[model samples]
Structures are given as structure tokens and as C-alpha cells.
Target: MITQLRVDDRLIHGQVALVWTKELNTPGIVVANDNAATNQMVQMTLKMATPTGKKLLIRSIDDAITVFNNPKASDMRLFVLTNSVTDALNIAKAVPNIEGINVANVGRFAENANESTQLSSTIMLTDSELDSLKELATLEVPVFSQVVPSNAQTPITALLKGIK
Candidate 1:
């Protein structure tokens, strides 16, 4: 029952708690990141950041795919968050029914010149990561880069061209 899939390097934070939660009306958040899944401290931090009473499952990508593929999962509105475009693409490939994905925030470390169009002082991208995101668009996932609910989103293709 994934209502929305978001790729944000920040994972769960203020924007997610305040904006996306209400917009999607999701009762649970499934974070698909291998690193975050293994780190107790990161998991604890994200759990704390999530709004009280909402469920949060920090799982590996494989676990997320399994949960997402289950036909019975449609009852709960689930929000899937991934840290990278590659991870997001991987999960989408595994669960083809996911249809669309929203690029919430790429964070500061992964931003690169190719992503300049989506640039905010808070996020950075690497060239390879940008290329990976471009490839993702070819798969027809409709990559959008936006920080919050009010900001205008720039398509990944448009951002790629602006890089050079």
C-alpha cells in the first residue's frame, strides 16, 4: 500500500513530518537503505524524527521490495523513502507496480554540476550520481527534484542539460 515513493538523502525529517505525512496521509514509512538499516543510531534518530504514533520501518531494499510486492499490503498507506536514485530505481525495478517516484531531496553530498538546476545550498550531487539519475529517467520514472511542498520541481533531464 505504497501511496508515494520519495528519494531523499535526508531520509525522515521536518519536511517529511510536516508536509508529506499530511499530504499522503500515510500511517507508516518504510525507509529502504542498507546503511541506515544496519546502523542503530541512525535508525533511532529517524524514528525519533517521525511524528508520534506513526509507524516507521527502516529496512533494507530487499525487505522493502518484499513488503511492497505483497498484494495484501494495500490497506495501509505506505511511504517508501530511499537515499539514492540508484536505490530508488532498483526498488522500483523490483516492484514494477510502484508507477511513480518523487525526488524529495538529494541532500548535500550527492549533488553535482549536472544537478545544478535542482541545486539548493543545502544539497550537493556527484557527477556519477547525476548520471545514474538520468538513466533512471530513461526507465520512465519521472524524476523530479524539489525541496519542500511549495518549491518548483525541475525535471532530471532539464537539470542534466543545465549542468554543462
Candidate 2:
């Protein structure tokens, strides 16, 4: 079962390696990103960053669904990580048992400035991103904005209420 579907552009970074995996008690991590799956450098980096003894798999979003829906993996505690909100949404839609989504880091790009709102120094969400998040919330899935397990979680629900 997927403990959480995390959206962090940084993918397998320090926090995810040292913090979330231990906190979630997941033995396996599935990175569902098309670009990362095809990029040798990114794949190598992710493998190196994963904690010792933990298993990490990089696959496209479609392949991730197949893994998650597999009955053989029902005993596995998998933490699904994605590079974008769209990727997380795709996984959530395909996998019925996703517990929730954690929005860790959404970096601001040059073009993103035009339609994005800065929620924090590290978080900038486009209007479309917010809409998708809102849609996820409507499905009764709690969305949290937290950089690491040590940080206090800020529910996207509360932030959206203020933004509206």
C-alpha cells in the first residue's frame, strides 16, 4: 500500500532519504516521473541518495500504477514520490488506496511567476496547481505542505481558504 504520494520536484533528496522514509516506515520507494526515469544522471543520483537497505524504483507514471495495483505488493509499504502535482494526481487517480499527498517543494520558474502565488520561499503554486489540489481535497484526500517530517505541517486546505 502507498503510505503517501509526495510531490517534491527534488525527488530523492536529503529530507526524503533521511526523514520521510523512516517516518513513514516504508521499505520501498517508487519515483513516478517520466523525465527522471529516462535521465541517466537523475536515475543514478536517486539511487545514490536512497538510504542504505531501502529499495528504490524509478518508473513512469503508468508503470507505477501497475506496481501499486499489484496484489503481490500488498504487503509492501511503498512511498510514492512524484516530480509534479500532475504526476501525483495521475497516481492518485490510478491507485485507489493512496493515503494522502504531501506537497514538499514546488520551485518557481521564470514563466511560473506570471500565474503563480508564492505560498512560501520554497513553495510557489500556479493557479492551475491550486485548482488541482482543491480537486484532490474534494475527493477527501488531505493535502499537506511540509518540507520535512520535522517541520510543522501546513494543510493546503487552510492556505487555500486564506488565498480565496
Q: Which candidate number has the best lDDT? A: 2
What are the runs in model 1 whose C-alpha is more than 4 Å off? 110-123, 162-164
TM-score of 1: 0.83
Q: Write model 2 residue lDDT over 3-36, tens digit each, in one string.
A: 8889887889898999899999988999999988
Clash number for candidate 1: 9
Worst lDDT window (10 residues) for model 2? 106-115
lDDT of 1 at 22: 84
TM-score leader: 2
Cα lDDT, all candidates: 0.75, 0.82
How many clashes show up per model?
Answer: 9, 0
Per-residue C-alpha lDDT of model 1 across residues 1-164, encoded as one tens digit per residue: 66778888889989998888887787898999999989999999998999987899888998888888888775767888988877887876777556357766674554354544344453355655566676777775656666666877666566567564
List where candidate 2 sits over 4 angstroms from the true fold: 109-111
